[model samples]
Target chain A: MGTALNPSYFMVLSAALFAIGLYGALSRKNAIAVLISIEIMLTAVNINLVAINKFLTPEAFIGQIFAIFVITVAAAEVGLGLAIIIAIYRNRHTVDLDDFNWMKW
Target chain B: MHFDFSLLTTELSMFILGLATFVLGLVVPSRSRRGIGAFALFGLLAVLGLTVLNWDQQGVLLNGMYLVDRYAMFFKILCLSTAILVIFGSLRYVNEHLGNHFEYYSTIVFATLGMMVIASAGDFISLYLGIELMTISFIILVAFRSQDGKSLEAGIKYLLQAGLSSAVILYGFSLIYAATGTIVILEVAHATLQGQASPLLIAGMVMLVAGLGFKVSAVPFHMWSPDVYEGAPTPVTAFLAVGSKAVSFAALLRLFVAGLAGVHQQWDILVAVLAALSMIIGNLVAIPQTNIKRLLAYSSIAQAGYLLVGLVTASPAGIKAVMFYSFLYVFATVGAFTVVAVVYNKIKSDEIADYAGLVQRAPLAAAVMLICLLSMAGIPPLAGFVGKFYLFSTVVSGYLWLVYLGLIMSMISVYYYLRVVLVMFRDDPKDPAPIEMGSAANITLIITMVATIFLGIYPNPLSEVANSAAISFFLK
Candidate 1:
């Protein structure tokens, strides 16, 4: 049974997910895209947490608990944050960040 | 579960009080904004009192990630009091210039709660949660006006950097967990102490610093401050400048100094380098600023550099100096901006030239402004001076050059500060309004003035408390 899972495989998955999220977060201008990137990044964390918890130390259940909490937080964060974004979009008529120049001279 | 009713009461009350402001905002249907301002002040004062009452009480709560203790209690009181002062001080301005004053006060309360959580966070879970809560709230607060493009821009800019920093931080978190198999800061600290310092762990630490650096607006990561300050509403900018920075620094102090105390030598050089860069770039760049907000933005960044001196040492005195500097930084910046808020409200501009003859129109505001800027310049008999003296010496005890560079930058700040004073006193106001100091704003002015000068002259009481608090974690 111990023959199936290796730590590096999980590490590679987490690393790829983190990089993709990093790219999306930095390149995307839309608020939603940026948030999606944040979600991806968060999932990347959970992946690592779960992977390490299962493979590295069975005694340390702390990382598993942390992963669960992070997921819940991410969900809640996106929900509240998106609602605000929608409100801003409704008032301003555009979600494009460039159009969000209310303070600019 | 023995319910710590009194302990839970403090946190719950903040949330309830803030929500009340929002609810009352909708239900009251009264145009008298003063009533809401007073309520907000009273709520914050109550929170402050609770923080003091439980100041020395230490206990673990919420899965041990969250802590309620003297250390956290001290900063809880600080954040609440600062919020109260800022809210009261800007009461009239909010009614006149800013819309949604109730929402504004409520957001400050929520943001303060987020900061308090960070102050007491005992583990990485709470730390990240607290920081994110504070950050997201600020993004909303910065763009509260929604229509202002600068506010929106500031919000988006902060979001962009903050987003990247979050990833970096999370990556570091994951990597650290990968290396040590734990995320609890105390547990991780224990692991690192016995384990070999691998290159991987150090790399993660570097990434972690990158993320934290952006939050604190330290050099190589402070590209956002000038624009953000220039664009966001004055009061929100004040919060970003002081409130956010203080909270982040509080968390950083705990994380780096306490959780990772065993590894101070390893990180000292890295942080010292960042400190030098901040002092050099923050001061020199500030030299050319014509806009008062932008100048202060750079000034604060430089002040961040000076405060890093205290971090470099990580001694009892260093921690004490750091906390003192943060308090001074928050109050002085808020105080300075309080007058700036008034000037901006009246003149509708933040250029230094607009403050010319501010003394004629708003003598009290001008006087407060003078004291704040003088304090910032580290002039004698001002809290800023005392804060800087202790902070720089903390670095100088070993790294003599840090103090030397700090002194040069202090001289550099003197020029801009005086330029501001000259404008305030020397020139006549163009179409000055009969200077109206709202009672709240006037009181904030007086509080900041007295606190800055009084603490400057005799810092014994505060210094003693802060010193003990700084070393409190280790000695226990």
Candidate 2:
């Protein structure tokens, strides 16, 4: 609370966190891990937006509003997407992406 | 405040048409789908007439978010024409192959509305809304046939990519607004030029380019094109290829070319690289495709690259070239896809070998395919040739190196175009295997054929229209 991150620091940290999340999502074999990694990426974006509003753009809160919107959208996506994944799993009984080759090239 | 009801009327008719179709689709039985389509066609024609009537309004509407200039007006007309033709040609195929026919028609109307909104958008806010509307509708359309796992995959991939890019774009907008203290495009343009480039504003501009570039399927962000196109219904693929791409290009024109005229130097080099990669990768990968739709999918990626050449020039002539190329491309690309739809309707397969002996079996359809293919290959006396002519000439005027690379891709494209023609003309006809296209599809094919061959030979009026439409983008 005593030391708030500036816009530049937030942008750089957001980019770094997003990159790490992307790597984890791509390299990991666990499907649930990929979902968790995506959550990490979304949180990074949210933190960047909130920090930008707090440090730089005090007159406007559009960034924070959009951040909330993103959170809602991410939640909805995971809810529906996970249900589909479970359906695929119940039918195929596998959670690894290699087993999800029903739609590949 | 000149409130032109005419401009409002054009968009209003289209929106009403969409709503009416949605309600009718819910109430009416599936067997009566043709009646709903007829009503949809009537709606499209009404919008077309209204757009033509206000063709010369050439003024801003809705407090400047929507510009009714000839440029925006012209592209709106093009999008509607393309949508109507897509619907017309695919009626038989959609009913036979696709599961949900009524919703397809309704979403197409909605997508067309999005394109019109984009063409008329004058500010970043409107542009963002228009693009989102278009993207969302298209994602739904792409996944319309959810029984197909490929379609579901395409939808998920597109949604994820589109969502990430939209975030980048939203951040760009926030940063730009903060730096300039205005969200209006023109005001931001003025401020960007008057003051030195700030770190936040320039970063925002970069993010903006990334976002729009993703929508247009430019390089580094075009990973979704091949899968999505191959997965969707053939007619929806056509709409995505021509309709969605054209709308995004229009948005790019409004934002990068018109709004960011002050920062041309900053974006040109970056765009040059994007154009180069898209052309090289798109054409090269397309050469060995056995599937016709995927082949055209990659060809579309290459086409986007060629269109990017004109965008990179950053001159009035360059903008005109992009406009003309887009108009010309609609006939060629859409025509090519329409032919695919006919073949898909008949054979129920998208393989190139399925097209063998087409020339002998369906002479009229094969001829349309030839014209469309050669037109795309940039052969003379077809629209693609003239479109490339304008684009290359503009690139030469400013960027000599890009022209060389662009022409190389053009030559490379010949390999794929000719492969289709070669199979059609050379392969022996199979026994009891000649496919027949529906009457509606035949008619759309004929119109596209005429537009391609005739427009290329005598491109005066169309070229002038493209020039004047582009000039309006520069004006205000």
Candidates in order, TM-scores: namely 0.93, 0.90
Instruction: Please provide, for model 1 over B1-476, each residue's C-alpha lDDT reduced to its tens digit, 9 standing for 90 to 100.
Output: 66565665678889999899888887886676558878988988988887777767777775556767666776777788778877877877778767646788888888888898888888877888888778878877876766665666676666656766866877787787788777667777887888888766776787777888888889989988888888778877887888888877887788777766666778888889888999899988988888899999998888888888888877778888888888887779899989889877777899998887888898899999999999999999899999999898887667998889889889988998898999889888787766787777888889999999899989999887777667665543
DockQ in order:
0.43, 0.22
TM-score of chain A of 2: 0.85
Off by over 4 Å in 2: A1-105, B1-7, B61-63
- Candidate 1's interface RMSD, please? 3.2
In model 2, how large is the Cα lDDT of residue B58? 72
- In candidate 2, which residue pairs get closer than 3 Å at backbone N, Cα or C atoms, i.e. clash? none
**Clash list (residue pairs), candidate 1:** A101-B149, A102-B148, A102-B149, A103-B148, A103-B149, A103-B150, A104-B149, A104-B150
Q: Candidate 1, residues A18-94: lDDT per residue as tens digits?
A: 88998888787788888888889888888988888898788868678878878776776677567657666666666
lDDT of each: 0.80, 0.80
TM-score of chain A of each: 0.89, 0.85
